[model samples]
Target chain A: MSNEITTRMGDGERVLFSAEEIREDIRVGTAQAAERAGIPALSAEEQEKLFDIIADPSRIVSVQPGEEVIVSDDGCSMSFYGGQDGGGVGAPLSRMQAVLTYERACGADTTSLGHSDYSFKPVKPIINFEANDYYNTSMVTTAPFFYGAQPNLGLYFQPDGPCPNAAELMPMGKIDAARQAQEEAAGHLTRDLVFVGSRLADVGLEGLNLDTSGSAGDADFLAALNAVARLKEKVPDLPILMGASGEFIIGMHGEVEYDGQRLAGLYPQDQVKVIETAGADIAGVAINTTTTESLPWNLSRSVTFMKAASEASNIPVHANVGMGVCGIPMMEQPPIDSVTRVSKALVQIGKADGL
Target chain B: MNKEIFESAADAILRGDPEKAAEVARKGLGEGIDPLTLISDGFVPGINKVGDMFECGQLFLPELVKAANAMQRATDIVNAAIPEGEGQTRGRIIIGTVEGDVHDIGKTIVVSLMKANGFEVMDLGRDVSTDRFVEAAEQFNADIIGTSALLTTTMEGQRRLEYKLKETGLKKRFKTMVGGAPITQRWAKRIGADAFAENASEAVKQAKALLET
Candidate 1:
């Protein structure tokens, strides 16, 4: 058999690397990431298996017949959200119709039915009794086997309402004012999450995704943690999936802290701990893709991070795999070669419970 | 100009201390330093250093953004002191995230870097419509119009903006630029944009080049 393995770079450029070199990178990278995160590294056997999976000659790879794991997706119906005016072509399906399509047509085990607003901040205004009608309708339309989900995007403090103007405050040399603005925004976001989250649960929502948590930085992350804590208090059994925006939390509010740990610069391994502490049932880990790196490099780094996060967390770990993250190239349509290899590695080597 | 005061101004920017940078600007102005001199000789150098460090991987996004905030604070104070007609920037630019996309951090960074580079930029914020972009460009009298699309679906908004400009017969009046995670040099060409940048630093360089041409 040929020793050469085909792969793509971060920019989706096709390239070839020898199996020996790919194995060495994966072995060293996973070990280093585990060491840095203070988590257990993948055993030598796992590393070898990962290398073998990645080095498979097929353009795309998948788990053997029975090795399939649970799958979930955030931000579904993106085309519908874009709408015709936003360049969406063809007649878009309604949100209810979209969820059914995902269940029956796409075979998604679970489907997230979200409004175009997506975030808790904007969804709050419409969440009053009127919002329940949509969720209730979704429940009736979707199949019983498919888990019905609702999503709340944890956005940063600004560019929405009910939060003080941090953007304006920061530019005016009002550091204290900006901090206060973020704090105020966090408070509003937490309340909104509790309000909307509890209401969605009340309508028989099976799962909730706190999608893209910490997009704003520490304060934004803190709000999600606080909201998750409160939501669990109200609905003890609802499954909550908290997904991250990137690998590291941006220190927008450089001094914000959560559960006595500094929130800024927390990587996937540490970030998952806080997710579990805040009562989330699933920790959705995302690794930011480096567009300049090779597919092997990015995949190795992503698996390394994912392995550490899975070992570090008590909850199920779902690695976010899509464009611009988790070894996927930054393209509109990511190639299956990279996507399947990364997904297989994540499941078999990184020990991800879901994707 | 007091050499020590200018150094302090630069030091504040390097430290990413917005309040201190603004205080230094006010102090420099009180001490008979020309407002333009305070910016050109004091704060700009500090921001330029930060930009260089960012490009070389010595700093990350948060540090760069904080430094940009500090530089902007100082610039605001200095600009206010200049006579209205005397205030001169390298060029005027209008930038925003295209319609239907809420991702703005990339565009925000570009705006910060553009402002740091002495471009008078009017930020239209995220989920901006094609009409708003054209109107803002006309209203701001912008030399260049830049748009960012973080999603494949929303990228058509960039193309729409291009068509809108062309339809208005104002396509030749101002240059257009496109960027984001999915954007590329080829996509820019396909969309009829004059320039495409991969990051904040490159955005500044491209904007500058667009103005010169």
Candidate 2:
């Protein structure tokens, strides 16, 4: 149904998300792979996993790593080192190395997950607090480095600055402070995203990154423009899925002046421009967390944030119900049903708007 | 007083005013109402509406996530009111997105589910290495350790985890479960994993099942 109706972007980028096209993609890329192994495709109730046995040209068994180690997640009872405060990098590193060692040890267990290329390249776990330049346009776009190794999935991306954990909602942008954080993180962190990618390859996971080191509001908008310009130059044909957090909306929520009764109804119009200019084909907005406190509360804050943002953004918007259904009690495990319910409710608005 | 406060609280949430919603919920509690009923009747329905709106594309991720935060405040109020020990829960679990793979969406979902279900959850967060998993388990005294690897390359890390546990002799200390976009029961067995659940729901089942083992 959706796959056949092809829509090309204004930039002539062919964006294909028709029902059939998407189905074929799922069938060929994910479903077929599962079928080949004689396994059923994962249900929404099932987690997504990727498995591969790479046959590469290069031999990797010979090279030693920046550090040789086994990695495992066995719960050794490590204390938090306050990561970047420089209070305890050593313990975290030691703990991290042991984990990597266990990941290596997984190899000693089976030949099926083995790769042709493997190396313990000298790289430290790059930790940064911030990425200062939301509008950083001059930096060269570096392609992810595999160097002969296939990567693992998942991207543990550190923001250019400290990622604000939101228990409450507040603040449209954190640029200057974020840049200061990046400054502190610039050199203290040992590796770049590329290094992270290569390390992921060493471990056997395909590396993925949701690059959102950009700040929110004006600087974020400028940052978006810069990133989009760079992406357009690098991969003009690429179809992008924009991931926006509800920073500004929450900021609006927490503005002491706004009445609690009506504040959620107000939306940040500027952010819509920022997202649209980012040149993404789709947008997924996540704005709250149980960790950070920009707002006074947690769960229901997402509704106003999502609604206002939806009314504002021109691109296809998808809401992220971060801790909603999972927040529901008696439900042992929140299914995709967490966001499904919210998305269902959000749709009624589209119907009302005749969209 | 019944639907009006709930609807208004929900409206406050949709308007992005969680403090107001919290205040409203607090007002209800002050009026001598049941906290459990407030949540079951008031909060859940509001969130359900938000969820529906999100599914319809009327709301975006940022909006929904924020509302989830707003709802968190409301939940905190409600949960605080619910007398302890009677809260519905299974047990504690340690979860991470695995080393190298940092897609936190699904992992976060699992963590939230654990918390909501009344299980103490120590989220090692994303791109967690094996040591941290072990350390978190030991520190949190977690009974179940769940690792997620969304990449094919990284699933091998999950595979390595089993052997690392055996080598360290920590295999018996905790029940190790692996899943992601690429993990399967065969891979789970090949790597000597105790269990593999398809998604978050299955993850809960597996986590619960392992505790009994």
Candidate 3:
């Protein structure tokens, strides 16, 4: 398809883009659109750099099998693997192996990767204004460039929130804004095999209060589902990962309206239907509990949630490992064994059903 | 003494039905039911059950928050009925998610659980600084100071709070409690924290235990 496209924006306004304009201007229109909508815009230099790498396939570099690639700033390098799937192509296992080997080589415990008492000053906020194609392309390109030696580096994108110029599209209502957002996402999907679409909740939940009304919540849910649909339409092979608290997913699956009602369920099996209906490739439940403090509960709950998600889609399920539980605040560093056990459990689950 | 009515109140809290819990609490108080009796026999038991369910993964944070809301509503009605000078509290605690950490779901769960268990919690919210922890503890006359950090990078804030307590010579004046996903009992001990709670129920136990010590 030619780059010339007449896209209907969120506000019922048709944004006419000529193939020549996009080729010449790169992402100046996206930035200008964001600025007009009162959202932040990236610096000219950053935008140029970002577009340069994405627009030109020649700028993208690949590592050959067994070639040494740098993994960390501390001069860490590892032999490259050819596979791209986690167990099959990606380097989750091999990355761990490299780390293990590196530590042993340095006369440190295989577990001692971080410093016992590392000191750092307060971090300044890094303003990120390019929240559209530039953002997606940057992540899609960067994550792999550093860790290209590892297996399965899929372009994981989460455009659950509206792009920077979303409000400009909002004149047409939430549905239109959502549709426009999806259209923008489609632009990003043209170049990369974005393997995973995550943070779908970001579309609805962003900039909204936690006590969002049922109508608003419903709109968000629809928007998220639509975002997934849009991404999938663009890249049929892309896997969509839906992120939310297990309770939230349970509520959605139960068709619980956003009336601020506390949704209680003994199990998450019922929530899987929503995932299937939304066309999610994998279910990602937030296991926001401390690994060591609540090991048994954490493991059991993760397994149960994953099993429910798995049963729903007959697909692999993943957990977003968050720190703390009801009583816990956060841990400095999780125990090596805790990390190992959880990884092993996830791997086992993946091995059994390819989750 | 209308035991069935009191039981209904407890059921409302357990079911996370705040409106029902409040309605029953108001009706019971109008009928001259003792405030302490309503709390002890009605709300406390109900919330304890919620705590148990939460620990076992039977109830998640949303359910726990609902139950806490119910308990709070009932507790407010019951507490308002008692004589002004006769108020009782388990302990006054100041809790917050530490600096550079914005995770609050876990902290919010702990806050609700602590409230359900009768602790007067002053939640300073997320991304709180060390001086703020010390300042809040001092201002609130807190018996316990709790800090939560979700990231490994921000976990140092907990240690910083511990250090500030020492530098200010308030270490012995207030008990320090540390928790989070990565915080183990060892880290708590290493940082000179008085207690390390694994979950909400354990937090209650540890808070009480720390005060006693």
Candidate 4:
């Protein structure tokens, strides 16, 4: 037919590949599969022309009713249909060994550095931050600390989940009832933790400002201590690695300078307060995402959180920027980055507070 | 002397006052100033100052975004007056926050910057998919496919899209670009991508270069 450049290169029309949208695409693709059965969209006579489109699209690029497309890069290594078996959405979930599984298996063709194997790292820094929100959410994580080691980190979700693992507000009424049925689901953490209702009777602190110099600080510290109390009651000598369950608390979803954070020498002090009150043995810290800061602030805050936690807690905090940075199952893009390193920041904070 | 205009413009834009910034730009433009000079010396300087403040514990995200918006508003005025066909189409780019990740602010900046630069943008929104990217690329004939991930879980989705593109033979058809929180240029190269941009500004430049190359 016509050999010309069909691509108009309109307003940034480049496709952004993602996994979430892929799942839906397969559904639509499978519908196309059912319609076409086995008729090839690229005809025997048009094979050369089809390859021409691969190199340049001014040729015959068509969708013959329900026929699927066979795409390839470089016009050489062509894989049939939307995927290997002409399966679109159902390809991943097919009974005959998933196409994704095959792609993940690094055969002779596996040349990528990220991995074809859907790798799941078992060991990575597991950080935690205390989120002020009543609901459990995944605050964005970033890498200022462990800056060079972005891929080496993994994120985990062990929020200060409700006793029934329910968020603070939801009707956990079913929690107690379901607990007996699923013994494994029964939670063991201490409950009804207390936080300061107001700033000190002396300090200028007032009304829920999160600075450590106030009543709200005292309340948060007391609450952390409560967790320690329960842990101590269970095991008196066990070294406790107190976790911060949040993102950042600087601004409203924290984004400004006044809302930004500084590394305080004494870190994860909320947990420290709990351990001190219970007279429990403190072990390590889990530097985590901030409550207010999402992924945008992840890298910077990850370092800051680690610094403060280590300064105050006097413990090795596992900084987790990789978990939040990758934006994996979400953006499908790699994580955002920062300039500092977690361990280095911790050491610096050590000097700041004469630690 | 030019720095004075830059500072005032930057100040106005940072305060969410694009109108004042635009007026400042017009004054400079009327005085036989180079377009690029006025852009970098006046408008861009202000935006960059705000961006720097945002980057180093100085400014905040909302404020930075707002400032960027204001700067964009002023720049649009300047750009419109530059006469038709004279301005270059920076590049057409598609950007998105990948699947499962809800954070869209960072990508929003990239989109804004690209759009402001005269690039035609087909934003697929957040929580995009690998196949959807291919679909959009094929449908739009996109020159550069961009993906942004804000979480570790979500970044893996980018790699998946890459492999899918390869297996489906779609990888070579267009330039694959990657960025976001966890994504580095090294990772982009390792994942077999065309290029990796560190920030929104860099992303626009890189995407333009990618498609042109």
Q: Which candidate wins on TM-score? A: 1
Candidate 4: tens digits of C-alpha lDDT, residues A1-355 = 2333222111111232233332233233223222222212222233232223222322222333443211111100111112311112323342212222333332211110111111111111111111221012111211100000001101111122222221110111232332232121111211221111111101211111111111111122333344445534544543333333232221111211111222112234333443344543332233332212222122223333333444455433333222222111112222212112222222332111211
lDDT of 2 by residue, A154-215 (tens): 11124212333221111112324433432333222212323433333333331122222222
Best by DockQ: 1
Ranking by DockQ: 1, 3, 2, 4
**Which ranges in model 4 have alpha carbons more than 4 Å from their true place?**
A1-355, B100-122, B137-143, B150-156, B163-174, B180-182, B198-205, B208-213
DockQ of each: 0.13, 0.04, 0.05, 0.03
Please, what is the TM-score per model? 0.74, 0.39, 0.54, 0.44
What value does DockQ give for candidate 2? Answer: 0.04
- Chain A structural similarity (TM-score) per candidate? 0.86, 0.33, 0.35, 0.27
**Count of backbone collisions within predicted model 2:** 137
Runs of candidate 2 exceeding 4 Å displacement: A1-355, B5-16, B30-32, B48-65, B90-92, B102-121, B160-179, B184-213
Q: Which number leads on lDDT?
A: 1
By summed lDDT, the worst window of 10 consecutive residues in model 2 chain B runs over B53-62
CA lDDT, candidate 3, residue B155: 81
